[model samples]
Target: MSFCSWFKEEEYRNHFEPGLYVCVECEYELFSSQAKYEHHTPWPAFTKTVHKDSVSKVPEEGRPGALKVSCGKCGNGLGHEFLKDGPDGKMSRF
Candidate 1:
């Protein structure tokens, strides 16, 4: 199956407990539940990503508040995330 298809499946969507997934663009091994799926938007988003180097921040485009992130290697838009107050009283981006 295609890499995007694998990630889009309902079984894998938002399910990070088992810790399985590889960065499609870089083929990097990512085994952390730190990444999660949020339905706030269309594409998948993680509460915490792998690392700054693993992804690239895309400048706001189109709309006034269009924050986006994309794969460094392929330039495929991963998703957008925003910082908000977490339950722990700490600011988090998800």
Candidate 2:
């Protein structure tokens, strides 16, 4: 998916209020703002989900280790995530 289509370029990006990010299509709780971080990318990046099963990851074809993320509650396409080493010297989902 394109970056513009996957993200909401609104108050959520610059704002840092602690809360949950819900799906636009289904209003399903996806991730918490607490785990949200800046990856120096144009899109909002999150390091964690609200629950272990909040989002489902499907392996992307022709892309090793890159998974497409979607809302587990409603199957709405959210974005893509990867398991990468965080800047804090720990492993995280980004």
Candidate 3:
């Protein structure tokens, strides 16, 4: 079995499956599966935000380069991404 198969089990589908899922913590949509997510040394692994309009980096008025990915519905921290390959084999910024 491959490393990703271990997470393909039904039990982890809600949390690790590859697809569009909603973040219960932030209510933002988690587009990629755990399989596509990579440990980029910032957070618990990272993946693209799925929807470009779903996230954005705006001027914080005081801080520069201060960008935050928030929930589309609630505007909470859904995490950020970098230019990387996703599990789908597409070049994306996750």
Candidate 4:
């Protein structure tokens, strides 16, 4: 199985239900599946965080004018955030 599938399966087996996601190390609740959607990207995508303090967006290194999302609690690099139009035709940062 693909790495994504394996990771998702482990999440499922661990009773990580929809609308909830936590950091592996700190157990800091991060993204909500409510904001999650298929973006056809290699990794999982979410429209927003469950709370504003859940993550911190920092300027990416060696990538001028780019942003990277990191875990607020443990400072883990979650992913990058993109400012673009969402599926709902609204401005979104994901």
- The predictions' CA RMSDs to the true structure, in order, are 5.9, 3.7, 8.7, 5.7
- Candidate 4, run of 10 with poorest lDDT: 1-10
- Could you give candidate 3's per-residue lDDT for residues 61-88 as a string of tens digits? 4545334455566665544333333334
lDDT of candidate model 3 versus the reference = 0.44
Candidate 4 stretches with Cα past 4 Å from truth are: 1-17, 85-91
Q: Write the per-residue lDDT of candidate 1 for residues 1-94, one digit (tens) a residue.
A: 0012325454455554756455666675432455554443333445454655555654466644345656655676555434332223333342
lDDT value, residue 46 of candidate 4: 62
Cα misplacement distance, residue 25 of candidate 2 (Å):
1.3
How much is 26 displaced in model 1, in angstroms? Answer: 2.9
Q: Candidate 1: global Cα-lDDT?
A: 0.47
Top candidate on TM-score is 2
lDDT of each residue in 1-94, candidate 2, tens digit only: 1112433454455656888888898888877888777554455667777877778878878877567778888888776655453435344553
Clashing pairs in 4: none
TM-score of each: 0.52, 0.74, 0.43, 0.67
Q: For model 2, how big is the CA root-mean-square deviation?
A: 3.7
Candidate 2 residue-wise lDDT at 1: 17
Where does the lowest 10-residue lDDT sum fall in candidate 3?
A: 1-10
Residue pairs of candidate 3 with colliding backbone atoms: 48-94, 71-76, 81-94, 82-94
lDDT of each: 0.47, 0.65, 0.44, 0.60
Clashes found in each candidate (C-alpha, N, C closer than 3 A): 0, 0, 4, 0
Question: Candidate 4, overall lDDT?
Answer: 0.60
